[model samples]
Target: MGVVPTDNELTGTVRSLRTSNSGLGIPKLLATLLSSQPEWSVSEKRLRKVIQRLKSEEETNFHPTSSLNSALDVSKYSNKLKPILFGPEKGKGLVATQDIDAGEVLWREDPFVYAPPWEIYEAQMAGTASWQDETRSNLTKGKGTSNKLGDESPLSKDAIWDTYRSFATLRNDQRWSHTSENDLARSQLENTFRRLHTVLINALYLQHSESQEDVTFDSTNTGSIPAPSRSAAHTKQLKRLLRVPIPEATLNSLFSWDGLMEGLGKMSLNLEAHGGLFPLHSHLNHACRPNVSIRHISPDGSTNSILHSPNPSRITVIAASLIPAGVELVVSYVDPSLDLRSRRRELRAWDFGICQCGRCLEEENSNSNTEHPEISGNRTKIEGGDERDVGQLEDELRGFLSV
Candidate 1:
């Protein structure tokens, strides 16, 4: 007779049954077991059906398509590339579905949100309640914020307290809420009133926009998110659009003393300060040898302008080399022209990962071989015995520092 099952073995079998059945109602479980496990012979199709049923339930109740996933939906972007869970270790990367030629425009993206230096400066100026012309006019009186508050830059704690006081004062004024001028001033002057502070506000606002259906912030009154304006009139209107309300919880989580420090960390890791936050662009992993090069293309038809502008500009990723279908696309995050040591160090420090690309690996091996010539010679000989092999080794040795 087959070994008699112990109580523990029976318990384990029942547990597996319960799991596979997904805690179905007693009546359903009895019927399913009777039909699927007749004579204890469950088929693969029945087990698969159980898994599909469980997954369908999970999808219906527990998991909704997330904002990031929604943003990355391939149909919304190009047909040339697709994002996927690249490999076991690398989380996400873009792969080519079709063979791409050199210099082809693989993708173009506009920043979801960005903060240029000017907006931050304007916010700082308004938060201080010091119109430069007014302050300059009062300079002769020696009683203006330019003199008494000259030491208080927006980054200082004193300036932050001043901003809070100023906001409170403005709120009390009858014109502050409805009057466009006062609304504009208060809009720019709220929060920490620093450039970085304003940028974080924008970043949070975009996140809020993305996840609004799933979660609600305390206040949705954060006025119209700031955008680049070309005229004084446009700037005035942009500043007065609307005020987004900051929930006390959100303030604590993102802008309190510790939260302020954390915002900087987010900026470093998640933001492209000069470039703006391009969710799709940030997904591309780094490599020592890159297949693509990014260029800031003109918002117009031509691709000339490469400098940061007041507004978000279109950025294009061009193929630098012919890439085959299904190949993982990579671009260098750090300057590839730097010496191997410097490039590796920069990648490790800023990117937080050592590149394992072919060039980086070769550099590492060459460095090791140089420190031990005998080992290098033995390996070179082991690789081949003919003159062609010797010539190849010499060429590799000569080109060791080329990258």
Candidate 2:
């Protein structure tokens, strides 16, 4: 019987609370949200649930390892790897709980979702146009088209395609504002955004299959559109971002683009370029000389005898070296054989930071020094020799260094 907060209002309230310097508790956060929307008859209990959900969502993005580890535990499959908080600067990372020898399996997980290349989506779009034209013609002629595959399920192809249309229509709100200098950049981003949108839609549909709750919508809550699941929150956020109306439930639910962008960014930085979204494997940080190596084995269970069982396809993380108990587990983000400059440049450009591993430190120092330990003995011998020998040695040193 009262006005409920709009999706925009709810999103704004959560953002405000998160950005505030003061650590406001549940009581204060609820009070702040209520105060911001006094016209709404939001009960304390209902508001608390909303606040908690948003906070938890924020925490999952900021500290990804917690959620990843929790998923691992819930699976009930014995995993040797554990997630560890490496402080605010480093974020969350993985560590070994026991000593692991080379070639021993540490952890194996199926990707939460995998996104195919953009070309597939482009082809699908071209195909859909012809179908739409036929549908329009049938409607104009007062004819109803029959759905021969009449399953009418929530995850039906028709429902998924409808959701995909809504998702794809939304613009890339993250793109730069219109300007002369940004014209070309914006043009390029259109294709990039479309590619991302396609992948996000597919991933969201896959994630929805894992949701346990039923979808419920409020009919008379004035100005309010509720999105029940975290997955729904994701789609609702994207709808809000593009100033689109809140999505209505189709086949009992709607897909979200909310965490898709953030998840993609994390995947880019943490996962191997060859890999897609392996949630558990992505948590392991980078090291110049990593103790772990990932092996991509076929689902048919070929090559490795350990993977002879009928498990789903997975990228197995095996110990590359003997890792001691409580040691941090890491893998190289880039080829370690590259020079110090190349390694750091690759990390800075793509991975967002340079490696602080021991191998990196040793290489950096050795590369910076003018004299090498191998050539130090040569210098000492020349100093003790006659002037003629010393001159010849100096010339020879210059030639050797140049080569």
- List, in order, the clash count of every candidate structure: 10, 2
Per-model TM-score versus the true fold: 0.41, 0.41
RMSD of 1: 18.8
| Candidate 2, residue 101: how far the Cα is off, in Å | 0.8
Q: Write the per-residue lDDT of candidate 2 for residues 259-312, one digit (tens) a residue.
A: 332353356343333435766766777887888887656656454432223432
Candidate 1 local lDDT, residue 163? 52
Cα-lDDT of candidate 2 = 0.56
Off by over 4 Å in 1: 1-71, 117-273, 299-311, 369-403
Model 2 deviation from the true structure expressed as Cα RMSD, one decimal place: 21.9
Pick out the ten consecutive residues of candidate 1 with the lowest summed lDDT: 208-217
> Model 1 misses residue 322 by how many Å?
0.7
Question: Tens digits of per-residue lDDT for model 1 on 1-403?
Answer: 2243444443445456678876686456546654644545443455455545655755554211221345466656678888777443455678899999999987777766654423444444444332232243243333444555666444333344445546545544554456888667767655323443343344333331242232222243344455421446655766777455668998787655455533332332311224366667766767778898877555564544333233334567889999999998887777778756556555545434456688877866876533332112223345355423343365356458552
Highest lDDT: give the candidate number. 2
Error of 1 at 108 (Å): 1.5
